[model samples]
Target: MPSLPTIVLVDDAAEVRSLVRLQLRLAGLGEVVGEGADGRDAVVLAAQWSPDVMLLDVSMPDLDGLGALPQVLEASPRTRVVMYSGFTDPALAEEAVRRGAVSFVQKSTDLDALVGEVRRLLPGEQPAAAPDAVPGAEDHDPRAAARELEQHVERFAGVFDDAAIGMATLTLQGRLVRANSALARVLGRESADVVGNHYPEVVRSGGDADGRLTAALERATRGDDDVVEVEHRYRGSHLRTTFSPVRDQRGRPLYVFAQCQDVTRQRQAEDQLRQAERRFRLLVEAVEDYAIFMLDPTGHIASWNSGAQRSKGWTAEEIVGQHFRVFYPVEVARSGHPEHELMLALRDGSYHEEGWRVRRDGSRFWAHVTITAVHDEEGHHIGFAKVTRDNSERHRLLEEQERYARALAEANERLERANHQLAAAAEDQAQFLAVTAHELRTPVSVLSMSGRTLGEHWRELDESERDEILEGMETSSARLQRLLGDLLTTSRIQASTLDLRLEDVELAAALAPTVDELRRVHVGAELRLEVEAGTRVRADPGRLAQVIENLVANAVKHGAPPITIRALAVEHSVEIEVRDAGEGVPVELLPRLFERFTSRGAGGTGLGLHIVRELSRAQGGDAWYDPVRTAFVVRLPASGPP
Candidate 1:
């Protein structure tokens, strides 16, 4: 029985060491003699176990596998070291090669390679780079060198087939001599099917232009270093080909090499980016309200659009390098607000506001402005994007509306005053109607009675008796004429043009005539006309006479006759009351009864009492109905005796 070669496994994890040990033993190459969890322990264990091969993990605590490789070799001089780790660090692998490591294998399921490397490194076999291992040297086996080269070719063939990029080789005549599985897949054909065909003919079958392929081949044949990107349609699908010239060391063309990759998705993205840029340009130019442009970091204008010329009166050629502060007034520029606003946008990415801006012609405008910082994909600040709108028209429209509103308010105030005066005039006309009705009805009643009586006694009377009766009728006729004159005076007050003929008149003297007139008209009721003898009021005598007559007449019509007319004179004014025995006014209606059309009497036109109220006021006094006493009071400014 031959003694089985000893194996030492090293890893930082127990599970990895256990699995590796199980796999190695299952392969029947060797039995695990010892195990270690770190590089240092692996080195110690190698010396202790004296294993034929030491499988060491490249990464460990305290000492990494590469650091412990020398220690493992020195401690166990006869033992072989094979680096086993998950990381494929080329630097670590090269270092192991320099440091006399037997071989390097990845920590994966390629356990056969592990056993093979171990078997090749066992004692009595020369190293890969032994001094006499080269062909044509002493003790060199030509058969062994040829066998090694064949194995290298087989391994490289598998690698070429599995490469990520498509690889192909063409002969000097542009024949597709050799092509990997990946290359065939890119061109949508089988590797064996295109082997004897010309490269251009195969590409033409796949929808690539024959002329483009031929031109590239010609360049490659001349050894001028041809390289190009070609697109081909294969199996109704698109493919991208990257072609490079393969040249010999003597500067002669050998074969053309081509690598193909799927650039369809990348090309689509670039097309989409171009379309998006086109749409953005259209949208920016279509904006009619904003003067959008770009500004360099120093606030110099960079580009201009149609809106810029329309809004700011500056064309692109004239303003491209001009400072943007030209759009600001002198005070605004002096305040450094424009520069500060741009700096803020540069710092924070966006700044927006509305303010007054100056145009190229020095005219000012209200502007809505925004400054946004443009940045690169890596977040480096580039410059500011500015957009401005001319809002001066809207501002002027608002000012016009405000001016119209102020004018409307003033007109409304004047109209309100005119309405109030018209209301007063209407009320005076109403009062005059009531007063005229009472004043004229008395004389009309007497003339009616006197003419009837004279007609009845004409046959019995003598000439003297008829003449005296006619003279009495004539006196009453004259009295009726005087009453009509007073009615005319109150109508002038309604037209808003009542003229006062001022005169010194005694209050008592004005009352006597009105009292006598009332007695004749309202004989069915008691009438009391009392005057404070020395009472006088300053006013138009004719107007005062009209005032006294109106008060007495109102007492007769609205009050029970035997209506008392009492006058009391004070320092500044005189008060006359027409006491009525009629039903007192309602509490709610008392205030409006003096207003025009406020009377509830059927025969009353509502203007009679309203006219008397206005007439009293026009004389610089006021008239009011006292609800408490059921009487109408007329206050008049005092006049001294004539």
Candidate 2:
């Protein structure tokens, strides 16, 4: 018992393959070795199985049986190709035989009667290239067969001459013996001009084509290589040329047969695609405000862009290959937040968020981040594409705005309460105007008179007289400046625009200047300070000074002196009192004294006491008149030096 002849069946229809496979097996003529659905698989099957016989369909997707026939023969030279199809046209059989099939069998043919035919066409020694004869040439007379062979050779020669691709035959010594019109056109010359020139020189229009190609051609001519292919420039067009050596029966190399194709369009298209990809990559890498990059599967950083380097302070060389967790806070990474983001992206296709992200310098930024799961054509998750934008400035601005809003609301609440309490006294604002004019008049008159006296008396007065006049002017100027400052502060306090820098302010140290200034201005009055040692309050120093100044002015303008400034350190707060030895504010006026425009005497603008109360409250404290002690008191939150 001999081994069964092996067979491969190919068809677009599965039923046809099954029917043929079963019939061949039932006939006991061969064993079914492989199956294919189309011409692409037919070539692969030929290469893999090298079956005794291959039954190939005439038509299939991607490549047809007729198209795959030569490739099949090239892949498995010893195996026989039997063209199989539903159509019974005799011309199909003739065409198949011309392209190197051993036989053509219609599907309608009875398998019982075809076993002997299949056996006759099994594996056998054959030429490596396609056969030259048409089907049925063996059945004709010798002269008729000779004529048929001549016609076949003539038809092949015509195909060679008129083919779209360039074809030429060259002597093994490298001379072009013949070239098709297509070859001549590819070389940018007449057919006659291209036919006799050395192939490489003809390709470049005169110069030697390239050293590597010359070597390849030499190797092909020497039979050292079975096939040689190269891509090179020719006549300003890109081309790919293949060289194959024709050999005699004893395996001696003859002339070299070559095929050339004008791949200029394809090459140009490929170059354009590569350039577009390069430009896109550069664009992604150059962006600086947004960090755009890629991560591999399992969350390792695969690419880093310029924005990532700029914002996160990590160069691509340092960050790439590290895990994406490197961009997250240590606690966040430990909590598996980065991995959670990856998982969420995988589940949802994309994840977007705005939150804090860590930087290389240990600083943090408010980052708007997006992570998108990336997939290949087959839809397998490969990695993630991440984009992060630094939004720290915007975040900070939003917070500051919220703080201002809260401050405004608090100011409005306090203003509302004060308006309710002072509703009956709204008519008193008219008196406030009168008080401002009268207070403003005193300083303006003193300045005008002092200037006149100084101008006239400079030559007439002695040194003591001149000094006393200038002192009067300086005191009036200081008083005028303090009044203007009070006015501006009132405007800012009402506008809610006043800003403060709070710190541990020592009451004694901070008040020394204001007390000395008062001593100079009120030269005959006794002004004293009693500050407990190391006493401090939590307040803005400049604002605290304003509060003290207003209280002192209130005592001097309304109550009488000697004025006493005292600081007392309490358990959770500190107290500062401005007192005068004169009779205290009347009981009836005391209730309305802290109101913005309530007046005690004609000498004051009535804003000093209100400002004192408001400024103290703004620094987390309050002010009031302690009638029993005959003192105007400010109580502020206590503090210790840091």
Candidate 3:
């Protein structure tokens, strides 16, 4: 009669809103004047109608109920907003109440209770007094009241029959009084068949099911608690069962309301997780190439794998409680390197290094080690995981390669030296060709000139003139012959075929003819002979003579006047000295004095001194220069010992 207490319904599901509206009408509690499918529409409808009560769903597409709550209240100041949701979260209900919601209701609440709550909150509504205390309460029509009670019971029955969750009611004697279709389906039976059956006999126990059902039911019946829950298997299906006691008005337990949920998927997921952990343990234990282990925060060894036992030479029993620093060399351990590595790993999440590590026998091996910080789900550092690989073989190979590289470098240096020597020899050969041509041309020019002069002026010249011309030709011929002989001797020496006819001879006598000839040829230079008579030497006469000739000729070409030839006897040798009066060779050129192609000035060929040394040596003597005395001295083996 109070304008039917108009209401506005808001829900995302049209069916849910329709159900609530039907329940309200059937219970004779209120009239739903308007409806909206979402919170935004709900706000608009509440403003337009200014309904007495607004039943708003919490979760809706676009502009949820909480977000629209204040706006709706602002628009319709007198509207009482009730937040309702399928979620049974008490915190959400409390929050909604705090945010100006007059009340909160779960979508799963019995239709009678929901209707009663709406009716209680209706405008101008007063709480009903007890039937005995109310004036004229007994005068009400029995038929109408009976019909209203019947509709309430029918609505409750409708909800219970249509519920998606498995639900049933059990009497205090443990007999099923009523069962929903969902619960009957879970038990693979008809609702009528389940209603009369004993609960414990219908639901069988599973693995380790030691009277859990009887215990949970007994606890609920004894008033110890309103609800008792247990997870067990029934008919090969995992189920989570909750027993809630439904008490009478006097607080005596009347029935147990049971809820059963199929949790097979959840149980399967848990089983898979346990199996994965077991497989990981087996894998870690089987690995043997790398030392895999864990270290606690204080650097003590915590876990060790089979790989760790083989690689680090420590069994789990030996190393598990020990400090990780024992695996490091003494020097490394003393330097706090192990702790430093752990600190780095903790700070940066991981650290890696390749260095020396000690084994159980105190032998050292190069190892590549990795340390990774291990943390719990809350991100608190607990310890470190370490992986170590022996790299000693790689290190040895690297060292061997370095040694091979050094040896190759030394060989390259030797090859470079040989190449330099070859280049020098090529240069000397080129110089010899040029100098020999010049030396040969000088003698040929003299012969050509003397022959032409003799042929043209033979009759016109006097005897002395002819004799002088003939003598000049003879000298040129002899010079040509001597040059040819030097070339031949050099060839023979190179071939290692220069044979010496050894003989004993007086050294002074052997040098006398060479000196006289040199004196006759160089009329301007004076010759002095300092001879020690009876200075005998073992010598080849021709080769020794050639040595004296080349030395004297060198002195004649390079020295000033007063060339002195001295012969002396020394221990085990005869010393022949050709001295000149000139400053000696430059100190820088002294080392290469007897080398081929070494000449002070251009007139004489550079081969002279080189040939002199070779020929002197062939005759069992050696030729060398005296820098201090400006002398070329020859030492021949003495013919007779002193």
Candidate 4:
């Protein structure tokens, strides 16, 4: 039995060390002659123990397995180290390969694969090959030599006339002695015709007199070089021809062997690939505003050409294999936007959006992006291809323009409303001024005309005429006084300064005085007052008198002569109605009759009825017109507790 090879086990954990040692023992690989807890320990232990194979963990507290690999190799040149770690980081795997680590495994890798790796790295292990001892050797023991010669013959015959490339043999003088079927076919001749032909007869150009064939043949024959391949033309067709010299026992050149291969398809495919690459480069350059790139299956950037770097401000080295979340802002990153988008794309085959993305310096830019899932020919999703464009400037301009439009619309609406209010105010002011002037002018003209008449007719006037003139003067003076009183009362009412002197009084008592005043002012109207004598109400005296007087005046001036004032006691109030036997007010004007300046007659200030209504309301009473009876009614509180 062969001696057992020594093995070294290195791991950061003690359990993995025992587990691997047990497995290796069961597999009969070797005994664990050395152990290490870290990459540095592995390196030191390997130098001291000089084991046949060193197994090291790729990750450790100090130096990683990959980092310590070169030191271990330098320390013990013959020791073979195998790397293992829980990390699936491809960069680490690639680095392990680069540093000449013989094997790599994840911690949870299949036990069979782990055993296979350990066995492959074991020293003094030979591959299963043909046995060195030949069959039927017996006492002569020449069978091994005979078998080696047979193998050489079999290999030489097996490749001599391969189909893909044609082979043939020629003499030193360039005469063809033998040819394979493929070579005959290439020359457009039968084998019999090509076998005895010379190179000059077969080649369109006379045998490369440039001495290339001669030099190749000389090197092979003198054992200087084994084989030579030259690109030459035969029958005006390009051919890759290989030359080797066949020699005798004394190493003298017997024949020059040549093989020809057709490379047209391969060269054409290469040219097509080059053209495709050129078009791809042009396409990438033409898209100036977009960052287009590719990602590996694990969402790491795989390809970042010039266009991507220019648009995103990321160099190829900075972004490749790093998570795409680097492009998202911190808020977006924490929300897992980049990962969510990738998942959606993987499920749906695409994702598209426009939003803000962060740059390396932490500034933001608006981006329009399209992510398309990349797949193999069989439709298995392999990765993602992303195209992003910086649309920050255009987005900003559009938002600014929309805001301007909204502002302009608001300004126009405000201006229109202001113009309308100004027009309305102008009309109201003009109406008020015209009405005021007319009311004043009529009174002043009456007083002036009466005075002038008295002055002119004093000598001619008898006692009766003088009395009438004096009475006319008195009437005009009373009218002027009434006008002034109404004006002052309206002003007080508008300013909310009118004070009420409340008292309990009979409703009839209030109406009697106003009726007498109305008859004295105009004897033409026939007025009558009827009331329940003892029916009383609680109200302001001056204000109640003003209400009755205004109603009586309204009827006398605007209605026919006969007027009747009636009073009654209802459940909680006394109602006084002033009725006129006259043409009823126009139905259209009834709704606004009690409003200020809404009287029918020109002599009426119109404030009389408005004041009447407002005074009644102020005394905890109300006034309303009864259109059915051509009557206006005033209702006051009864003399009782509310």
Top model by TM-score, which number? 3
lDDT of each: 0.66, 0.71, 0.72, 0.67
The regions of model 2 sitting more than 4 angstroms off are 1-433, 461-472
lDDT of 2 by residue, 5-119 (tens): 7888888655346445544543456788899977889999999999988888764544567778999999999888888653343545666787898887754323332444676
Ranking by lDDT: 3, 2, 4, 1
Candidate scoring better on lDDT of 3 and 4: 3
TM-score of 4: 0.35
Model 4 residue runs over 4 Å out of place are 1-428, 452-457
Question: Can you write out model 4's per-residue Cα lDDT over 1-642, one digit (the tens) per residue?
Answer: 876888888876554565566556545788788888666888788889888888887644345466678899988889887777543434455557667888776553223456568778776654322224423335333334334433533453354444445766554444454466677666667666554345545653433545565555556445343356566555555566666544332333334556666555656777997999899767855676668888887778998877678767888888888988889888888998888899999999999988888877777888888888999999888899988878875677546856997997999799879969964543333333324433443234334433433343345446865575466557656766777778788889878999778888867777677778778877878888888677788888777877877887778777886888888788898888888888867787788889875656434456788888888888888888888767898888899532
State the weakest 10-residue window (summed lDDT) of model 1: 126-135
Residue pairs clashing, model 2: none
- Name the better of 1 and 3 by lDDT: 3
List, residue by residue over 229-343, the lDDT tens digit for candidate 1: 5566555556666454443212344345555666666567779979998998678567876799999888999999888998999989999999899999999899999899998
TM-scores vs. true structure, each candidate? 0.31, 0.33, 0.38, 0.35
lDDT of 3 by residue, 232-298 (tens): 7777878777776544323444446677778888789889979998997677457686788989999
Report the C-alpha displacement of residue 197, candidate 2, in angstroms.
99
